[model samples]
Structure formats: structure tokens, C-alpha cells
Target: MLIKWISAAALAGALLASPATAVDLTVWAQTDLSPSASLGPVAEAFTDLYARFQRENPDITLKYEILPGGTEALPNLLTAASVGNLPDVAILDSFWVARLAETGHLQPLNDLWPAAERADVLPAAIDTMTFDGKIYAAMFSNAWRGVFYRTDQAKSLGIDAPPASWDEFLAFADKAKAAGMKPIMIPGADTEVTTLHLISTFWGFGGDLVDATGKPIFFEGANRTALEKTYALYRDLVQRGLLGTEVSTMDEKALRPFFYTGEAAAIANTSSGLQQMYSDAPTLKGNIGVFALPLPDGGRAAPILGGQTWGIFADDDAHKQAAWKLVSFMLQPANLTAIDAAKGYLPVNQAVWAQPFYAGDPLMQQFKGIFDGAKIVKTRPPVPIYPTISSALSQQVAGILNGTLTPTVAVDQARDIVMAEYTRQSAR
Candidate 1:
């Protein structure tokens, strides 16, 4: 017979368990909003929140690692996951969330956070994270891509406000050109920026890569029209010397110097750029304005909403629980307030914008207007093979700009590539 020996203190400790016995958690965050001088405040806000979280729960140690920008960090993440060493939490681009979820690498949050609770998030903000009818991540912020224009330039051009339709926009561009000003500053060499700006026009023209049936639909009337319009704009700008020869070499960073110095009348950029301009050129703060990209037919303006999201790694129950707690804490209204105030990103929590900090800001008010009527905003196709689809579009757009391919042919090629990718994804 075996003798059973248990200390009374051991029995009492087991019976009176505390959260201090919880597991440590690790978070991997991409460094998009951290390095910028204007955006540094936002990073500090997140750090403050993390500090408060640690103070509240001393038992659960939290570690956050900042990853490099762009695709350079993806390989490291993949390697870590392959070795069963994934972080407890990570921030992902909304576009990548579906792909990650499909790999079974992320935990679905729907089971833990009820649909009713998630209803608080804007529909557009939540759409990308929902794959196969399951919610996998929580939207952290809402971002919009549109034209940033100089208010005085618009006034001097006899335009009191930014164009409300594609026709009006073109007219304004023509007027600006006749007045000896570069109407728009676009970095043609930066495929990412060019593709993103062109996609906004595709949406404005009511074209999309995927349909309601979840089928690929890129070769069509609106898509062709949008592509033709984009190609024409590119050729006209390049030939007119409105866009510098260095366009092919200019990235978003290089294009910024042109805009801030007022070399170009307008630019297609994200709202975060506006925040930076405010800090770098404070005197020009009230001289700039933001507006949605107008449709060709003078109908509703459409803009693309893009941003990062918080996700949980598929892991043990304890880790999952701790991750959820962190997410919930970070999403609290106060935390979102701090985030928006610091980062210049729109809050996913609607209530956060109603705060005193944002209420008096006119530019913030204009952003709210654009965001409120942003139902037309849509994500690229949610298939796990979106990277391939994005690449094909980028290449086709480049070919169109380089005069190697017509818009019609480029769109046809993009459609074929998307269909093939869809087929490949379906097979898996």
C-alpha cells in the first residue's frame, strides 16, 4: 500500500487559488505607428495602457515585441509558429487576418466575445476580420484613404472645396494645370501607394474584385472603366510633366516633401499623413482639408477603410484567457480615446469620438463626416491567397502606367490571375 502524504498548507493553497498563478503573455506588434515623430505619442499611449495592465495584474507578465515594417517580419512570425512558439497575441493588418485564420493559426473570438458585444464596432471595421462567417479578430482602429488638398490652393483655383465628383475633380486638376501647378503628387514608383490609390478609384466606380456570392469578378464594365481612367490619368500627368521623372523612384516618404512644401496641389494619402503635416507644419494646419474620392457620375464619394487588428494565437486555454483579457482592456473607451489622441487613427469604438478631446477639432469633424458616409468602403477579397491577388493587380497597374499594357488587357489579366488564385484556394 502507498502512503499518501500532503501538507495542510498545500491543500489550502490549492483550494484558495489566485490569479497570480496565471501564465505570462507575449504580444507581437508591427511597428507602423511607433517610429514617426508625430505618431510617437500614440506609441506612448499604448505603453501606458500596458503599464496599467501590468499593475492591475502583477501575476500575468506581459511582453510586447515590435516587428519591422512590411513583409520582412512575416518570415520570422512563420518560423516561430512552426516551432510551436507563437506569441499569445499579435496585431495584424486586417487584410492578413483572413489568411492567418484560414491557416488555423488564430483563435476565433466570436466564441468568447458574443456577437452583441462586437456590434459596437463599425461594420466596415469588422468586415475583414470575419472569415467564413466567423469573427477572428477585434478591430483596433479605422483608417481612410483619400485626397489631401491645400485649402488655399483650392481657393486660388476658384474651387471653394475639394471636388465632390470625378468630373469635378478632373476639372479642378485641369484648372490647376492651366494655372501652372501640379494638380496631384503621386509616387508612381511605389507600387503599394499607386495600387492603393487606384483601388480607391475602382471602388468609387463601383467595381470590386469579389461578388456577393464570394466569386471573383474583376473583368467587368466598371473595372475596365476605372482602369482606363487611372491609366489615362497616369499618362497625362507624366507627359504634361505634372509628375516628375523621379515618380517611379519616389515612395510615400519622398512624395511627402513635395506635398508639405506645397509643390503639389493635392495628394492621395491616409489620414495619418494629415496628422503628421499638422505637427511638421503647424502653420499650415488650417490650410489643409480632407475629402473622399468622388464618383465619376457625381454621386456618393467612396473611400477605402484600412487599419490593424488585434488577434489571439491558437494556444492553451490559459494563454487564450489572458489574451482576451488584454484585448478587452485595450478596447475600453478610455484606452481607445488615448489611442486616437496619440496616433491620429480613428477609434473603432464610436463613443470614443464623442469625447471632449475630439469634439472641438474641425479636421476631426471632417474625418467623422467621411467616416460616417463610408458604407461604400470595402476590403479586397478575403481569400487566403489575397497576397497573390494584390501582387497581380499591382503588376498590372504598373504595366498600364509604363504603356506596356492597355487598361482592358491589364484588367483581363488581373481577372484571370484572381480566378486562378480562387481556384487554388478552393482546392485547399
Candidate 2:
């Protein structure tokens, strides 16, 4: 036994010392990690960081694969998992973490990650990467959503401040419309953004899309009532002309042109828009002001901490250690600050938030204030059927906006569409 242990130790030392024996691990993501002129500064920073990592750890080299977002990413990951050919790490969309972790193939990283290092992230942000009470991934970047209004537009329209309460929001809209300005626009062109802009409205009324066990329960009991009320608000907004029918056709990309052209007084968007606002309409950047969506009876909006997370899938011990090393390095305060600040992504790492970038940027400070005021932050549920649930709700939401379905019928139909998949996920 002593002789065998010594031999194994010697082999390990030799491999560690040899450059040819370096671990070459794979990392897959929907986002571009390589430096590209078309991509933002964050990607460029990440590209530099990757090169730095390779230099620092001469024993590891990462193989990168950029996959198609939404349409093919999950399917590719699933196929890879089924064939036992999964990468050492993958960038998981917030919604994909729950589904991918359900495969029982993703290794729970809690044992490898130190609790002290984990504490640097927001507790709610960390919750997004958790499934079945195990931490499956590490979340570093985030896109915090809120309502962005033209500050000068609001001032000229005689609005003293952004709406603070639901009643105030309604009054503010009335004033803006009276002044020949379109009130607020919430984009509904896709499954994700459609629900994202208004889901917090449902949350404010004390409703969560799922229960503690990760079952779809938004259609049950008071949750049903809250959702109905939430949907009714949208239907009523359209009926009253406060929110436009064109919203159903508008995506986040469309929102910039609408707002910049002096068409819409306000729009709901993510923190990343801070950079886009400057790039798309530098003249309007200073005019823009951000506020959380006003919920009924003064309930503060709980910012949904949604973003890409890194999950390790490697089964071998050497690859696991190497993958985690790369992930942890990328998530370090300085590295995260470099990328997140440059790109205007809200930082999930508290240490990154403390950096001068966030402190100096007024737009980011507003987002941070909105993020800090909330009590119960929301993340996509830890269930595989979340995309199904989101899709159903999004479709019904569009129908509700178009007057093709009542709020009750919309909720009922959405429930019918996703229940089976929800049940299957629950069973797993």
C-alpha cells in the first residue's frame, strides 16, 4: 500500500510539472466569450481575462464552444449529457439551471466552493443557481429589470416624480397621456420579456409562480386571484389606452427606438440598457431615469435576479478542479467588476457592486437602490417546466392585450397548457 501510494504521488507530481499534461477542458455558452469588435466591452474584458487565466494556470487550457441561444442551447446540452460528453463547464441561462440540473448529471458544486467565497454574492442571486436544496452553479452577472422613463419628458409633462404607488402610476399615466405623451410601454414580443416586465406586479400582490416544492401554483387559491388581478390591470390598461396594443408586438430592442424617437414616455427594461441608452441615444441618456414598477398598495417590486450561471458537468476530479478554478477566477471581484461595469450588467457579487464603477455611475446607483429596497427577490423557479410556464403566460398575456381572451380565460388556458409538463418536472 505504501509503495503504491508513493508511485501515484510521483505520477501526479510529474503530470503537474509537465506542460503537455495540462488539462484541456471545455466551456460552452450561448454568449460570445472571444474578443469581438461587434460585442460589448464586457466580452472583450472576459476575453482578456480568459487569456490571463491561461497564463496564470499553465496546467489548464479551455476549449470554447458558443452555441445558439434559446433555440438550440438546451437541446445541445441535453444531448451532450445523454451521451456522457458534457463539457467541463457551461453558461446556463437562469431558466436553464433548474432544467439542466434535473438531469442528475450536473455535479453539486457546494462541496468544492467555500462558503466564505459564496457569501460575496447576494443571497437571492445565489438562490437562482440552487436546485433541490443543492447549489448547482455559481451566478456572477445579473440583469436587473426596472421601468426607465425619460426624465425630461416626465418633467415637461408636469410629472413631479416617477410613480411610487399603483394609484400614482395610474395618475401619472393620465397626466402623460393628457400632455400628448404616450405613458408607459412594456414589451411583450417574447416568452421571457413578456412575463418579466409584469411578473413583479403579480409578485407584489403576494403571488409566486410556484410553491416551495417547485410546483406550479400560480393558478391556485389566492395566487390565482393575484394573477387575475395582475392580468386585469394589463387588460384594463389596454382598454383605457394607458398601455398600447402595439406593446404586444414590441421587444426590448424595439423599445429603444420608440423611446428615443420621443414616442413613448416610459419603458420597462433591464439594467444593461444603461449602456445601450448611451450608444443608441446619447442625447437621451441623461434624460432617462429608472424606477421599479409600481405595485399595488405600495408593495416594492422584488427585482428578479436573472442572468447566466456557470455550471460544472465534468465527472473527472482533475477537470472538476480545473473548471472550478476558471469559474472562481472569472467571478473574482476585480474581474467581475471589469466586465459587469463596462457592459452595465448589474453585479451579483456585492464586492463588485462596491467598486468605483457602480459607485461613480449614477444610473447604476439608481438600479442598486431599486434592488436593495425589495424584501423578497424573485428568480425563475427551480423546476424544469419554467420555460413552458413562461411561454404559456406570455401567449395568454398577448391574447389578453389583444382582447382575444379575458384575464380569467387567459389564466385558465395557460394553466391547461403547462400543467402536464409541470407535473412531470415535479415528479422528477
* Prediction-by-prediction clash tally: 0, 0
For model 2 the local lDDT of residue 330 reads: 83
Each model's Cα RMSD? 6.0, 6.4
Point to the candidate with the largest TM-score.
Answer: 2
lDDT of 1 by residue, 1-428 (tens): 12334576677787577565767898888765432223667767877888998888766788778776766666767777778777899877777776677668889888778667677788767767777777888887877677788888889889997787677878887887788777777656636666677677666666676667766665666666765666565665666555554555555666777677777887767775666767778867778787876654565436666677889994788889889988888888788778767767877667777777677778788888887776576766666455665667776655655667777777778778878878888888
Task: List, residue by residue over 1-428, the lDDT tens digit for candidate 2.
Answer: 99999999999998667587589989887664344424577567868888999889988987888777664788998898899888899778767777788888888988988999999888977776776679998887788777888878888877767788889888888887887778888887755787877677788777879877667898999989888888887888888888888888887778778788878888878776677777778897657788887766578566777876789998889999999999888888898887776677888887888899888777778878887887767876756567788888888878888898998998899899889776666677
Worst 10 residues of 1 by lDDT: 31-40
Clashing pairs in 2: none
In angstroms, the error of model 2 at 116 is 1.6
* TM-scores for every predicted model: 0.85, 0.89
C-alpha displacement of 5 in model 2, angstroms?
A: 43
Q: Relative to the true structure, how large is the alpha-carbon lDDT of every model?
A: 0.72, 0.80
